[model samples]
Target: MLKGLIFDLDGVLTDSAKFHLAAWNNLAQELGIKLTSAQLDSLRGISRMDSLNLILKYGKQENKYTKTQKEEFAAEKNEKFLEQVETMTPADILPGITELLADAKKAGLKMCIASASKNAPKILSKLGIASQFDQIVNPALLERGKPDPEIYQRAQQLLQLHNDEVISFEDAAAGVAAIKAAHQFAVGIGDKQILKGADYIVKSTKELKLDKIVAVFKRNNKKVG
Candidate 1:
């Protein structure tokens, strides 16, 4: 039986990713680092420092800055992003997300947010859904980012559920990889091809149903670590 549900916050819960991209683009432009929109897309499901590292890698100029400077850069980008998202409200909450969260709670499934964003608390608050989650696992407590499983593992641990009894919802390839690495069933939200690693795929939360999610996992019943 499914005992818990862990969600990736950015694209899965809301539409704040655009703000993140804008923030990163602003910083990149200032630093003489030309980042294509495609390159900035990779920042999803990664930690602040990891995102900074990816940007440096894209620019092929990691050797130019000390680790301290990189940290500062990430902070600056986060500040810009936060400013852009400060006005978010319940209206900003994604369609079907509220219903899913309500259904998960009613079904006795523990629910949590496992996001790479360090500002998860603020974002959830802005969306007026902070109280819906049992726990929020951001990048602050982990040594690694999404696609590594550390964050998801911690989230499952927090929920006190076995890997087989837990499942995750994600929107990015890296987030799906993290859920699989954590040995849980994955429900991908987005294009099917990009989310092939997931056990199940739905276009959006609007089309999701708890029965369908459980059915997929039961039929598969396979661990994928």
Candidate 2:
């Protein structure tokens, strides 16, 4: 049996990725740089500071900004992102997420969020489900970001669960990589074609069936059932 569910925030819980892309694009334009969708996609599941650095490097504009300038640009991007998400209500909760949370809770599974975003708690609060999680691992608490496995490892440790006892839900390639690197089962919530290393891939969070998730764990370890 799976003892816990770890989730990524931006693309998994909220439709904030589009807003992030917009913010990055807008900020890039302000810096006299151009951003491609592919470049924007690579920023998913990364911290804002790391994302800003990636954008600067990709656009060949790293020399254009000092550390202070980078911070200012990143801060401006987040301000825009928060402004856009301010309009989101509980109505914007992802399909099946509320039900999934209720079901998981009833089934005795510990639930937590492990996100690179420093904004994870605020986003969950805005969605009216701040108290749903047993624990939350945000960027603020970690010295390193996703793809490093630190965040997920910390969340598992905080929840008192082993890697096999928890299953992570992710929407981006980097997130999937992090979960796997942490030695946890990962469910990729997006097109499988786009995410190659996930243990299981689903079209959306709404399509996630607990039984199926458990089955994957069962396949990995006979004790999971």
Candidate 2 to truth, TM? 0.96
lDDT for 55 in candidate 2 is 89
Task: Estimate every model's Cα lDDT from 0 to 1.
Answer: 0.86, 0.87
Model 1 has an lDDT value of: 0.86
Strongest candidate by TM-score: 2
lDDT of 2 at 22: 92
Per-residue C-alpha lDDT of model 2 across residues 1-225, encoded as one tens digit per residue: 579999998888888788888999999888777888788899999999999989888889878878898888989999999998888789888888888888888899998899887777788888899999999985786888888899999999989999888999999998998999999998999878777789889898898888878887789777443
RMSD in order of candidates: 1.8, 1.6
lDDT of model 2 at position 145: 86
Q: Which segments of candidate 1 are over 4 A away from where they belong?
A: 222-225
Q: Model 1, poorest ten-residue lDDT window? A: 216-225
Which residue pairs show collisions in model 1?
none
